[model samples]
Target: MDYTATLNSMGQGLCYALVSILFIFLAKKLDDWRTKNFDDDRHIDDGNLAVGLRRAGLYLGIAIGMIGALSGESAGFRTDMLYLLVDGVLITGCLFFSRFINDFVMMGNMNNDRECVKVFILGDGRTVTGNTALGTVEAGMYIATGFILNGSMSGSGGSFVQSLGSALLFFVLGQFVLLGFGLVYEMITPFNLRDEIKQNNPAAGIALAGILIALGIILKASLSGPFTGWVNDIVGFFVYTLFGMILLIGFNALVDRFLLPTTNIATEIKEDKNVAAMVLVQATIIAVALIIAHAI
Candidate 1:
């Protein structure tokens, strides 16, 4: 065995161990803060805020480390490190900003008595299951992977328009995959899948699948041309849908189980005619943000 190789491996192991310890310490601190200000009604928002702060801090630290490493490394290391730093900063910033916006919107909705939560298309009030979150994450992972591949496959001096179109096509394909998996899971589950779809019944799932697949094909077509265009209209739809569903169900459950049926403003808004309109507006904003993100 090469002594130099062994020493290098030990150094890398120490670096990872230190990073892990720092993460653990940060998690412990955040947990303590949450316990100190624990209010059942506002737990989700508080937790989100804590997570956002921690993520921002972690990313910033990582970015700084990358920059430092790049400053003292070979050209190849410098190039790779710079990419890592930029990507880290972008991801962390997006996450923190999104969480902040979501929290603000949630609070505003509560104050205005609007219903922002719907678990499924059927408007069933169920908390978001782990399966749903995993599905969404998996879709996101695939979309990102596709984007990286698109960039790599684009030959030297590739058009930005072509690259962007390719990324969007991949993203829509990822969404279709997610919906397909969800449909399959629904069919295999013990519960009636028909009850899960909105007004259209089980056929609704089939309809949605068809629509997404068609959109994916359209995106693929758009990428074929030079001008570059997006085929998918419903960007970040799944994430927001899951979030709204989980949040609404969890909040309603808390109120029903713990608080008395007080004639409060928030409760009144839940039943108001304007609640659905508010949800539509929120959904539109989310869609726009997602589109802009992809474009950038």
Candidate 2:
């Protein structure tokens, strides 16, 4: 073993750790500042899962988006830092915008910012507040964007500009794919998913969130690997995304038929608001996504 190389590796890891900590700290502060409606610290202390989950998503997103930049061959310290900076800004900005897109589009008319945390007035006129079920869906969007960025930014074959453009394009594509999937899911479900979420149904939210994040994972794989050419890369992205979607749909069917054949999956999630059923579905979907991500 070369002691010199080992020391170099250790130093690089330490540097990465420090940079990651700083990014997370700033992401937290930025998210809190934008929330505007409630004291994040206070709401978290009061057991607001909605606020907490939203916060966690950003945290997780920052971490996930950093994976590609942190890994791979270092192009000298200065170049690595430059790459990290550019990709970091893109990841952060896209995630911030992702919230609005998800809220306005897939959510179908629900306002996540307004619903995630709300203020209520009691008979005594004292105000109280808590996170709503919508927070989970927002959290999913954050994490999913992170994954898409990770894919777009991964690999070392492209020019920096090319890679950056790929990242942006894939980010947009990921959102559209997610929106498409949402429509398809809506078509299959017997109930109105957006309505259930509006009624504060956690199960409905969980199921939707699961599929979003799982698809994000798959897209990460789809976008990843060596960048061949613009045309090749774009074609490859769509092809992989289509394959991933098919696999995801197939697994959902499997879960419904074999994994939990006794119950109506829709009834459990939409009617009974069965968190456990949704959790199981989510777990199965994520498990399958992990396998596909690894294979890709």
Candidate 3:
């Protein structure tokens, strides 16, 4: 390799190491926080440790698989497959280390005198807090993966360091984008479908389905051509599809609860009008945000 290429590879490796260290530290801190505040069960339980490790492994495998696919050269399908296998194993190994540390901290801090707290694993408006430590770990992995993928594309020669840095940047950017989309969706289309289900509102369900379909269409459109090509160039199309699905579900729930009400015709009509306006506003915001981000 040329001098510049050598330097680029070295830099990428360093970046990967730094990214790994950062995530490991984050996982450890999260574990500490969880043990101090959340896990009241005094005795260290293997079950929680196992669960956390499994979750980490699963996410790591996914990230690696994704990266491998994205890194494939067109010359040989076999080469692509090998790349996926190797990278997936490497990434998964790193994830395992992070999980091990997380588990140690959590289990070590368990106190026998305290009762274990039940935490919410999913959903909004939940009373109990979920495993924030695990969440942080997962998020860290995603960020790391995004950084690595982007770095590789930027002529960094797929060095671990460069990829990790690029993945981290993408993770931050993705979070902001998701947050903006979420808030805009909420403000424009607030409806409670849970309440509707309790009251058996057929129209509410229909409205929810419609909203989901519309959002799906918009996502498909946004991912067309150059935008999709660029995203695929880095993280691959699968990740984008997965992300789009997540957003779809979240948006659907918001519409069901906030936009559609199980009430009189007059109220429903009023709500529908609001929902239409909200949909327009959300669509516009999402389009604008995507355009701006892509341009940048």
- The lDDT leader among the candidates is 2
- lDDT, candidate 3, equals 0.39
lDDT of 3 by residue, 83-103 (tens): 444444444444444334323
Residue 259 lDDT in candidate 1:
39
lDDT of each: 0.33, 0.83, 0.39
Instruction: List clashing residue pairs in candidate 1.
Output: 113-269
RMSD of each: 16.1, 3.0, 14.1
Candidate no. 2 TM-score: 0.93
**Candidate 2 residue lDDT tens string, 1-296:** 99999998798778877776678888888878887666888878988778888888888988899886676677887688777877777888888888878889988878776776776554478754543557888888889889988888887787889888888888898889888987897778788888877767778889888988999999898887888988888899889888988898888988888877788679888768889888988899999999999987
Q: What would the TM-scores of all predictions be?
A: 0.26, 0.93, 0.30
Comparing candidate 2 with candidate 3, which one achieves the higher TM-score?
2
**How big is the positional error of residue 29 in model 1, measured in Å on the Cα after superposition?**
8.6
Model 1, 1-296: lDDT tens per residue? 99998997677546544543454354345434544533322433544322233233333333332222222223353454444344333333332332233223312222111111213232565443112221222222222222222222222223434433443444444434434544453443344433322222222223222222222222322222222223332243334334433433343344434432444313322333132332333333334334533443
Best by TM-score: 2
The per-residue C-alpha lDDT of model 3 at residue 14 equals 58
Q: Give the Å shift of residue 190 in candidate 1.
A: 18
